[model samples]
Target: MPRRASGPRLYLDKKRRQWAIRDGANFIRTGCPEAKLEWAEKLLAKYIAAKYSPPKSASPPIADILLFYLKDRVPMMKSRSAKYNVANLEKFWGDKLLSDVTPANCRAYARTRSQSAARADLEKLQSAINHWHSERATLPAIPKVWKPPRNEPRDRWLTVSEAARLVKASKRAEHLKRFVLLGLYTGSRAGVLRTLEWSWIDLEAGTMRRRAPGASEVANKRTPPIRLPRKLKHFLRRWKVADGGQCKYVVHYNGQPILRDPWRSWKEACKAAGLVGVHPHVLRHTRATWMVQRGVPPWQAAGYLGMTVRVLEATYGHHSPDWQAEAADI
Candidate 1:
């Protein structure tokens, strides 16, 4: 018998009168033995003359790969957004195979997420999809199906007096104090800030690095060192003295690790300062806005804040003094 040129032969189980061997991806054998037998006889004759096909390796099933991610990867991720991502995926693609996840399917998922019952959840799904595609090396091409809803404009920056008051009121709250100071000085994201360690800080050099969640211990993927403001040097020097010899983290409360969620403490800090609606993450925005207002370009401000230029411009630029000043001057 000669070799087949393509896929494996679709065999007809003539004795049982059924078709066998269906590859889920690209090849499907008809269940009717009558159809397969008629085709098989033609194929056997062609094989005798040397023109038949052989089977190829099928890629791993998408559903199995997704299950692996949910079971192993999502649980290991440190970001707060992981749970919501898992939920959105379960809503739309819990059972779909990886090969079956087409661009259209992704697009449809995106569309459904846009009109999601909750707006916050809509963005959550977007990030989840991005995370999913970024995680699985083998996946159908991701499709852009929907644009996120416009977020309301918010000016969450603390006034200078408010920051001073918040800091003073937070004196009794050690971690919040350190977190606020770091937020004011480093302009790093809340996610990266929560995970920063003393090991990543070069005290003498007055610099700290940003590390995203889920990056390998050995791989500081996407995290790069950022130089601290010269103005903050004196404050850190004093902080270091009080921190005692050395610790695994630069920030702590009574020598204990801090919670990743700063909302409760942040709200408390805001209320103590007689301000309302302030979020811990807003301190980051405040610093970045102040920098750009002080003549720093969006690109430089973005790098300082661990954000992209586009994000820096879009989200914080409106609050920039320079932007407002320029508009007034124009």
Candidate 2:
């Protein structure tokens, strides 16, 4: 008996413990039984057809490409901020083809939305298109998207006295005091804190495990635990003792977790503290600013705040007392 020549080679992959089909340089692994040569051939045919198939058009629908990109990229996104980008981009340009997305189209989108929103959407689109092109080795000429001027990072920060005032004022609102304190001390986002469970916190160890809800701890690279400040730890101790230490969440109202927006209570606390335009996120800014002002290293501050060193430098570098101080000596 002689071996028959086939379109592509087929063999058993010992490492994968599966039958594999080789299409030129590409290998497709399948769980088909080794004796099932007919199934392997069918799979190889499908794989080769899909792999070598020409694009339906020179430029497919932008929406189609965007969908593909989102399918691949969304899972890797560790923050909820990407949702805004996805929504905005799809809303404006989902129907258009890649070739039809012109500078004017981008400008029109920008005009309809704010420049910041346009910038975010276009940047996401650009990234998606770039990835698609890289995968297919087809680089189509694309219009340049205009980006809005980057605004100066907000410098609003609360002094220790101001923070104390806000925390004290928030005591009137159930759970707001602890929320404010945790925000100011940990620099964790409101969403993270709101869905936080008792299991993640370690009072004796003086640490709290932090990660975006529904995100995989092992898969997500961005969200990580933040150390509890001594003040926050002490506050938590007292809070736990008072609450009988049985509640599932750290911030609760009348034995229930505070899951929804706490805007009313936040506003009241801000007003009482005489702070203007302050929000939950400002507590994060305040914490980062305070850390930099107190001479904490940029890397350490970034780690504590669950951001990168580049972001730390770009946003809060100016607040660091040591930053650019040597220029005066020169």
TM-score of each: 0.60, 0.71
Give every collision pair in model 2: none
Among these predicted structures, which one has the highest lDDT?
Answer: 2
* lDDT (tens digit, per residue) of candidate 2 on 38-139: 898788777764454335344777776676666666668756666678777888787787776777787788788776667777788888777667664466
Best by TM-score: 2
lDDT of 1 by residue, 1-330 (tens): 975455545655667777654323444445556655766555545443332221121343433444445554667665556566656666676666545455567556666755433344444444444555665453356534344456565667766787799888777677777788888887766666666676676678887666533445322224557897787777777877888856556676667666575677777777788977677777776787678768787777776666677777877776666566766887
> Which 10 successive residues of model 2 have the least lDDT summed?
49-58
Error of 2 at 206 (Å): 1.7
